[model samples]
Target chain A: MHKVVTVDMEKDILAENRRLADENRALLEEHDIRAFDFLGAIGSGKTLIIEKLVDHLKSKGKESAAIAGDVSGDDDYQRLVAHGIPAANISTGKECHLDAHLVDHALEDLPLDKIDYLFIENVGNLVCPVDFPLGSHVRVVVISVTEGDDMVRKHPAIFAFSDVIVINKIDLAEAMQVDPRILERDARRINPGAKIVKMDARHGNGLDDLISALGL
Target chain B: MHEFSVMSQIIEGLLEESKKWSAVKVEEVFLDLGDFTMLGEEQLKFSYEILSKDTILQGSTLTINHVKGTIECDCGFKGEMSPSEDSPHRIVPILECPKCRGPARIISGRECTIKNLRLVVPDV
Candidate 1:
């Protein structure tokens, strides 16, 4: 016996995203809160870069904080508290991705008016975050040379999603036989519009280029 | 990995939807699985079967229709992808249009959405 099935979907995801993102952008414009999202794979130094970014922003008399998403996110929360920067951790529990709803929830604790910059360090995954929008002004995708030469080829979604690509761990590039230029070339091929930065955060190299990208 | 999380939301949506009408048993749930997304159908169905059991959405079937990846060429032609059956493969022939042969910007994929919910409310 064959049975008939029909369905009615009330909400369309992309349409809803376009609509809600417009609303979030409007609120941000009204309040003057400039936000950026740091997205990358695990061990790619997204957290380290964001942590350093907070200090760099503070040196210029700009206040900034971070929203770290994790299963045990409060580690970053504690670190932020110790640094005297306001922060929160969106404990996604089992969710691999962070979305605008999570960002909206994280903002409840922030003084959006007082801060000049806000950073959202999303969960460390290339695939999941590519699909979700955080309502950020910029999406900075970080890739380390040590990960491999084929990173851009394997993760087009991540590269295409990037407004800026940070090729980190350059200090080890020579020993690892990793060419950062190749990364930039491939990124250019994938997303010609994205600016690429080569950095060794531990050595404080290329920090100025990053700051320039942030317009600070 | 995100499939489980999305499935949870779908179940929640279904439960809330079922409460709107009395004596209705869900027949089918239609969903759009984006090609850009990394969800697995086997994982989705297995998890959904377990998640929907004994709740308001008990015994419901999940149907996922995969949306094709469409890229529009710089030369004004568009078509579905024809990537080879290989792992770690880049999407190629790099947007060469069948007509004008130019680069293509991917227009689709990244649309992991729950499109429909079908239920049979008993004739009252």
Candidate 2:
């Protein structure tokens, strides 16, 4: 005879990812590495901000490495390498976001003992990357003024969860008719505890503020 | 999209659970999906259908219980939030305290869990 049974699972779909993330966190802690996960849309200056941060950290006698995540291209990886930053390129194939598992694998490929700060540049998309945590010490979301002042409000989840929100490309805010203050206000409304830093990353503006905000 | 990846996880979990129970087939899946996840129901179903093909879960029914997004603020305000009108997709909701209009912590609507499963097993 066949019988139908109702099984009580109560299983979290992202439980595995969360567990892996915790493991990554533990690994980072064990190695005393400060890792930051960067999330942003394309053209949000995430790469530039990371590049600048790596440069600044290097000047302070701190060693830094990066894991550049993209869908296919290794352009960001090349940029980081061109700057002499040790970076691993992670191609997610068709995936839109970088998960903890991918970061775990990337961590193996890096020189953990030689690194003080590890920057993980996630795939360039705001919405999809919000839910996935990559075992970083802090989660930074970058948004450029060219994206508009309402970018934070439109993508509340990402802003709400981020520890630091970088408002990049402020130099063009006037030309774009977008006020950086408006972006800051929106970010504050969404996540009051998040450190909001406005920057012209291309011109090296707000680097100190960002560094202080990150406590690095 | 990521729904495909998520569905694969669900199927993997279901299969493991079925193996433990010695289930011959899966009949239905009950999921509690939170609004904050921003996962489309259609996309999830499509992913499920595609991923479950030729598996024990083939032809199984998928039921998604959408959990509304709610928040709790330090100001003692607690309730559901409305989607931001300014959102281009009209799906991303404002996550501030409705009363105090300050940043609030998400209490629900981010869940993506498989609460239960209907399986076919041999009579013991």
Candidate 3:
């Protein structure tokens, strides 16, 4: 006769990803690399901000590398490489977020020894990326004013968990009829301890403030 | 969607657990899905149906028990939150404290886990 058996697993669904993230953290620490995971929605200017950060770091004599995670194209990867930064392109075939496993693989392709800083541009999504931690020292969430002031209120979890919140594209705030102060208030409300920075990454506005907020 | 990816991981865990139990067939999987996770139940079921095909977990019953989202405020208030009407979707939780109206820390609703499983095995 066949009998029924009950197994008490009580396991987290994302446990594997969490384990790998810890391993990635250890690996990064071993290599003395300060990695930042940039998360945002599409058109939030994550790539441009990263490019600007890389340039600033380079000018300070600090070498930087990047891993661009996209669903298909390597456009962001190309942009970073064109700016004279080492970057790896990860095409997350049907996945919406970059998990720690993917970052581990991308780390294999980078020159970890030569890099002082690493920027991981997660798949351009605010919602999905919130659940997956990619083993970065700092998690930066970039939201543009063009997306509207409700961006933070609508996606509170990402803003709440992130270490730094970047309100990019402030140059068009008036043209878009969006106020950066409202975004800052919302972010502060969601995460009081998080450092909030407003900037126009394209025009290099507020870059120094962002740099200071990042403790770079 | 990420539901497919999450379901894939669940299926892998189920299969491994079944092997440990020496089960001839898997029967049911119970999950505690938290409201704060923002994972769709229908999407998760659909993903399970697709990913479990031909595996030991095929045709298994997937039961999801939704856990209510809760938060704790620095002002010493703790409770659940109702979705704001302004939210685009009902699943998006309001992270502010109802009492203090300040940013509250999520205390429980973010969990996505396999609580347990049932298997069929030969009586030995």
Q: Could you report the Cα RMSD, in angstroms, for every candidate shown?
A: 3.7, 2.1, 2.3
What DockQ does each candidate score versus the true complex, computed on alpha carbons?
Answer: 0.35, 0.66, 0.58
What lDDT does candidate 1 reach at residue B124?
47
Q: Mind giving the per-residue lDDT tens digits that candidate 3 earns over B13-120?
A: 888989988898889999999887858899999999999898888899999999988888889998886556556356556566778777677888778999999899
Writing each residue's lDDT as its tens digit, candidate 2 over A1-216 gives 889999999998876787899999999989899999999999899888888888888888999999999999899999998878788999998999999999999999999998899999999988788768889989999999999877777677798878899999899989999988988987887777788998889998898899999998
* A121-213 per-residue lDDT for model 3 (tens digits): 999887898778889999999999999988888788788678899999999999999988999987876677688999999999999999999
| TM-scores for all predictions | 0.84, 0.93, 0.91
- Each candidate: what lDDT? 0.75, 0.88, 0.88
Model 2's DockQ score:
0.66
Q: Provide backbone clash counts, one per model.
A: 0, 0, 0
Q: TM-score winner between 2 and 3, please give it.
A: 2
Question: Taking the tens digit of each residue's C-alpha lDDT, what string does model 1 give over B6-104?
Answer: 777777777776676553578778888767656678988988998988875778778889877677766667777445333435442223344554445
- lDDT for A177 (candidate 2): 98
Question: Can you give the lDDT of residue A211 in candidate 3?
Answer: 95
- Roughly what TM-score does model 1 have, to 2 decimal places? 0.84
